[model samples]
Target: MLTSSNANKKRTPNRLSQHLDVLLFSRTRLEGIKQRRAMWTDKQRGIRLSQHELLCKNSCGYYGNPAWQGFCSKCWRERVRPAEARRLDTRESGEVTTPTFSKFEEKKNMEKGRRINTMRRLFWGGPSPPKQPSDSQMNALKAFQKLEPGDFTGFLKTLRSPSCQRLQSRCTAFLNTMEAYHALQVQKQSDLVQDFYQSFAEYFTSFSEAELTRTMEHVEKLIMTRLHKWVFCHDSCDDEQKDLTLQRRIRSLNWVTPQMLSVPFPEMQSTITGDPFLPAITAIIEMDAKRAPQDKLVCVSKCSQHVFEALSTSNSEPANADDFLSALVYVVLKANPPRLHSNMQYVIRFGLPQSLMAGESGYYFTNLSCAVAFIEKLDGRSLNLSPEEFEGYMRRGRAPAAASGVQAAACETRHLLDELMSRQERLDHGVDALNVQLQTWVQAVHAQIDQATSQLALVQEEVTDISLSASSSTSSDSAEIEHLILTDEHVGSPDTDC
Candidate 1:
């Protein structure tokens, strides 16, 4: 209204001079960031007081000045103390003395009699006086005055004479024969020093010292004394004159016979009194009932003649009838509740027959032909049997007619068709004896692979003639190293153009 109040008081001092130049440029950038953080904290406390005065002058030889205060003004003027310099030279020189005790006991009794006369002149042999008679001790006293026979003044006037009482009875019989030859040389040198300290306490008790000198040379070759003459007639006989000459040579011997004293001895026939192998196993079951079913030979000749007369009247040893018929055919095919009929499940469920006779069928067919000839010689080198386990052991010895009866079904169908055609002819003769032992083990592995391929072609022709004589000695050492590199390049050629 008064000319628009003079242009709005000139834009109000230009907006209060732009807020006093942005509050004096934010108070001069906060006093230049507090004087650059107080000059970077006085340059990090002057680099930590110059790294603590160069780490106290490289640790303790301290050329100091840690802001100077307690000593160390570079080793405080080379410090010195020696008891305050010997109390200032004993207060500038002022002396005093004292020391008596009878002149120290006459200087300790003249140093204790000069160390007991120098340890009695080093233990007695030092007096230095006696050596006078030398011309070889006056020629060994004139060779004991020509072997002195009666002279030490007529042996002291013949020791008052009677011919010196026969020279004192021959000098008391030569000192009782030199004390019985020095008591038998001190009892044979105390039994050779108690047999060398009981053989060095039985060779160092438990060896070492080269195993006690090889066990004292194997106890001096096993010291059995009488150094031999048939060990000194067997230690001079005497065990009651060798048991009265072995009971007068077994009462004038006569080899024993009468059928070896009526046999028995099948291990003393189970302590005798009967069971003589049950009358030779009932005469081998009446001679395997007169043969005939392909001539029943499984009779094992009366159990191989009563196990060869019980191994020749029990001297025992025999056994191996094919390992006792393969342990009696594994105790008649896996024994388990079987061991030959406890009425073997009512004779394998009713079919009986085997009325074991003929010397219990020749001891049960010589223990089943010694266990089918020891499992046919261990299945002729291990095929281990198959053909249906040998047709189930010939159909378990066929017989089960509902537990056999009707008068033992015609001797159990003729002993089960003669033990099923003698076990199908012993399993077709054990597959023709294991195909003739696998063609004799393939002709002994083709004659040992043709004698190991002719000894590996004569050891590869002697390692190819020792690698052609080591490649002709490495081509004659590369022609003598190319004739010593052409005679060292023709004696180091300097140009005589050969």
Candidate 2:
């Protein structure tokens, strides 16, 4: 029993010793694993910190871990940006800085070398630099790089110079010339309008009394045809041939005085003996006998007596013999007597200007030439009066029997003046309307200029505001750089160094 117990004790001690050996081996394996993990972690952290320090030093001339670095990434980026920008600027400008051999004298040597090289390249093309420039070369290159007058810089300078007052004067002169030209054009237009009126007058005035009678007959026929069409509703007419016959008849009709048509019998002799009306009537008869004795006489004694009585009773003066003779001529020449009265009244009311009356007489034939001369100066084809022919006509004097011709001329003159006045009134109305339109156009131009000026002012204000804002931002950035420098100086020292 003792041997069995001793064997059990020995087995137990060996099992316990095996258990302790397993525990100790397991603990040692765990410690070795922890040591390897710590070594790997330390190596990785060291590598990261070293990489960060290298990057910072190269980029910003400073070195440290990223988190505890003296300078921030933003600050480092800002500092490097200016250096890169300066390098790029130098490269673009074709200017390179040479390295200095000695740090103590670096700046002085670099500056001297730069100046010498620049001067050498400027004055000499050969390998050896020239000692001095020739007179011509010096003069030529002295101002070569400078902006001259009429160049971009010079132009900008002149724009701001007081000498620019000359531009305002030039603009004023141009405006004056434009206004003068406009006035001359207006005068030319006025002359044209007047010439048109005068030519219209001469066209009618040149017609003989026989021609006047024919024209009136033609117009009357046209009026009659139109009236027939309106009353009878016929679109076609055979009146053209009949109108020509009527016109021929009207032209053939002779002008005669009232006295030739109103020879009184013995019953009317008592009123006519030594009477005032007798003298006027006798004058008309004698004038008619001298001028146109072959003309037919129509005795309307009762009408003649009534006309004389009406003239005597009315306060208005008796018609002059010349006027009476013209009236007698008009009545005899008309184809349709009833329409003649109204037409005659229209002719007398507005067509009795003395200048036109004088132009019709052989004595005042020079005035007709003047009218023709004026018309020839116009540009239109409607009426072309040759100035040479008009002057020739004026140089020649009047015919022998001027007085008798004057009476007939005055009647024709009245008709021409009436037609011209009507045309002139129409032209005046057209000119007034055109003036109104021109005024409107001028107003519109002024308004457009005003609007453009206002918009330009607004745009200039916006540009000015933007430029000021940019300048303020630049100043703020400069202030930030100074602040960063101050912060670096304070933070880089020891805790008690501030």
Candidate 3:
């Protein structure tokens, strides 16, 4: 019994030593795992700090947003401030508004900003002081600001005077026109577009299928011609793009017209209609019906005509062809509200005058009569010209030398008419010489006055045809003689006799 007890006691000591060795191994593995985890944690912390350094570090200078997730501190406050204010009045929060300034006001604001900035820089360190306006520029600005309606005549004279030198030109080229004039012009065209509807009353009553067909054909030609012209001006649109754009426009026009025309204009008439397939047919019918009295001339799209048609439309009217085209696109967008573009709209709103005023590229289509009409409405006289002299003037002034040239041309015209009227010369032979002399007189006018160039081109073309036809005449023309006698007094009014 004593021997068995001794053996058991020896085995128990061996078991205790084995248990201690297993505990030591386990502790070593746990310590190694902890060290690795600590190293990994340190690496992650370094990476997060580096990423933070790269992002916008500027504080928005608002409260609590730095604690919030994804919100910019300054932006959130600004956005919320308007909304919070509306808590009292239910008005919707408006966008952060930008203040607009006139040239003089803008200059003043800029100077103020510079002063503030300069003071800051003096305290700290920054850019040099801002450049100041010249004395002439300042004086010009002051003078233009003080100009009243009654000052219009005096303004022109002053601007033209030696004192202003080139200051008037510079101010006009920069500050005289408002910054938004181009945008305003475009908006005006859009507004006046509805004035054209009255002209289409005749079409509403009688919508012919043949007329519709002709309109479609005409519109297709119009589209191709316009696109071809556009591609020439905008070289950025490559040949492939141009072809794709043309096809898209053709398809859109095809789609849009049918959709619009198919809807019955119950207001138009009881039975009149056009092809649903062609928008041009629809437009042409309207255009044909809209024609003004042939006796006197009228262009519905002209600023004067559109204004006369609807006084309120001046603000809404489209400025030019681009404005018209854009308005059509806006119309299409509002109706369907679809994701569109490419093949979704007409390349241009169709018309002779509409196409002509598109830009410099469309200048080829300019009708001199239409241009004369337009120029009359566009700024009439330079600020330097006297209102009395300007009002009575024949040509819109180019320069002092140019105006004097017109007087010279008129004097020569009087001499030529005197020779023609004296009847010392035969009507047959003298007419050619008279026509040649008249052509020379206009050519001289064209050389001196830029505006007269277009006038001369139109006049010369008609004169050449008349001179050739009249050359074979044999009758003693007493009526023409009377007209020649009257010509001396109205030499400046070239179209008066006609």
**Among all candidates shown, the one with the greatest lDDT:** 1
What overall lDDT goes with each candidate model? 0.38, 0.38, 0.36
Q: Candidate 2's residue-wise lDDT over 106-207, tens digit each? A: 544564467455333322332254334345434322322243422434433433344333322332343343334433432232222222223222323434
Task: State the lDDT of candidate 3 residue by residue for 158-183, as single tens digits.
Answer: 55665455433433332222232323
lDDT of 3: 0.36
Worst 10 residues of 1 by lDDT: 344-353
Instruction: Tell me the TM-score of model 1.
Output: 0.17
Q: What is the TM-score of candidate 3?
A: 0.18
CA RMSD, predictions in order: 51.5, 64.4, 41.6
Residues 289-364 of candidate 1: C-alpha lDDT, one tens digit per residue:
3212111323334544554554444445554333333323322222211112211111111111122112244234
TM-score of each: 0.17, 0.19, 0.18
Give candidate 2's whole-model lDDT.
0.38
